[model samples]
Target: MAGRLYLVPAWLSEDAPVESVLPTTVLERIRTLNDFVVEDAKSARRFLTACGHPGPMRDVAMKELNEHTAARDVPDLLEAVRAGRDVGLLSEAGVPAVADPGSLLVAAAHAEGIAVVPLSGPSSIVLALMASGLEGQRFRFLGYLPADASERTKAILELEKRSARERETQVFIETPYRNDALFASLLESCRPGTRIAIAVDLTGPEESVRMQAVEAWRRKPATIGKRPATFLLLA
Candidate 1:
């Protein structure tokens, strides 16, 4: 039997009543997934507990699919199929493999002839672009930025150049703690008129997407810093 792989969206807290899920419909669909593979084990368990679906959470049937294991253990996930289990790949929040730690497993599953299933749901990249008031038709999600400050700045310079030449929406993210630093770097590095969007705590009550000039951003107080967030840049 072909192993079934489900890509479930983690947009809101399981205990969250309603308002937290931007569009009510997104949460409606999430209720159906019976099993999940989380990027953070502790968080995943907390989510399950909030959803009123806590189970034995057997170790044999579950795993953490985060950066710690995505590269080295992706192939091992296929054994789940051999074991006759329909598995789900989840993340700490939002969509999996979209800057999350599920891409390796996705590639492995396809290579091994495992069925890939994606559930329609929220994507911070798309949501940020949509709300940014920027051109959404042509966009590229750059995922996360480099760890080193100088390297990250260099990457930003290159990407800004790419955006100018190609008329593309360049999107990327940074570690929660470095949000302020990245934001500052972008403001200082990019051109004054460069249009940028930052989506923070998307889909939750704290959700916000800021779109404005790089210079303009520096004038205003920083809106996000070291929080779960994503960013989008448009030329």
Candidate 2:
């Protein structure tokens, strides 16, 4: 019989306790696997250590699959699974394959006739939307916006327009260090009546989720320093 591919979620914050973000059953499932395809081997090691893997760190086999990984090389990462050895796919944070490079591996797994199992865990995107109090039923996740200032501003306006027309919520993220810039662009480009939600450090002690009209935000602006954050908008 072919082995199964488990999609494991990692903690949003290193400080978050494993028991708080992951179910006991998920942890037990993770402990049973020794081979994994990870975004970063070092971070994967740290996460497995936190999960209390029984074997030594050296014994766990991890294959790297990140932005730098070539598409053609993705198939090779599944060699262990093809050989009847179960493997885990882990993201740097949150659930694997959503807004993550691990999606490529998941696609490959499906094409190769492997059973893919998703383990329950925290996801920043979903958590942010749940707290945003926006239109959860009809929403779209727009991955990272353009790094260029003008392009990002234009994209923001377009998304806001779409949200209003379709009554859908628009969710997106930004590079941690450039969060402040994106926040500024939103305030400047979006109409005063439009609502914006900013969720930062989700699942961590410093967690914050705030939603208000653009005008209100301008009056009481926030600084989303260098931390992971999710942005949402509703027109």
Candidate 3:
């Protein structure tokens, strides 16, 4: 039989202890694997080390799959699994596949009849939604917004309109360095009644989750600096 493909999750914060976010069962599952497809080899090595893998670092086989990886090459990452050796798919942080390039490999695994198993772990997106206290029953995750100022403003307005019309929560993320710009655009473009929630440094020591109307936010504008954050909006 072809080997199973395990979707592994990594810690959200580099400084957080492994047991804090990952359960003992997840760590035990990781210890049994020797082959992995990762977004970043360096971070993947660190994550595996934290999990206390049984073998030496050099003995663990790893293949990289990131934004720069070609579409044609994604399928090749599964060659070890095809040969009956279990493989793990890991993201730079959080769970694999969602908002990650590892989705390409997961799709390929499905096409080849490999059994894909998702191990339990912290997901910043889900954690943010849980804390936002918004319309979790009906929501959508829109990945990322446009970087251009004008385009971003237009996108923010469109998201607000869609949220109002559908009564759904809109979720998205921003690059750490550009988080402030995105926050500014939201304050400027969204209607005063629209609700916005900003979740920063989730699962880390500096974690913060705040939600209020656009009008309230403007009254007390906050800076996200360079921390990783998630944005949620409702109207």
Q: Whose lDDT is greatest here?
A: 2
lDDT of 3 at 113: 90
Over 4 Å off, model 1:
12-36, 58-60, 70-72, 221-223
Please list the Cα RMSD from the true structure of every candidate, rounded to 1 decimal place.
3.1, 0.7, 0.8
**Separate clash counts for every candidate:** 2, 0, 0
> Residue 21 of model 3: what lDDT?
97
Relative to the true structure, how large is the alpha-carbon lDDT of every model? 0.73, 0.95, 0.94
Q: Report the backbone clash tally of model 1.
A: 2
lDDT of 2 by residue, 106-157 (tens): 9999999999999999999999999999999999998999999999989998
Error in Å for residue 32 of model 3: 1.2
**Clashing pairs in model 2?**
none
Ranking 1 against 2 by TM-score, winner: 2
Better of 2 and 3 by lDDT: 2
**CA displacement after TM-score superposition, residue 198 of candidate 2 (Å):** 0.5
Root-mean-square deviation of candidate 2: 0.7
Give the deviation of candidate 1 from the true structure as CA RMSD.
3.1
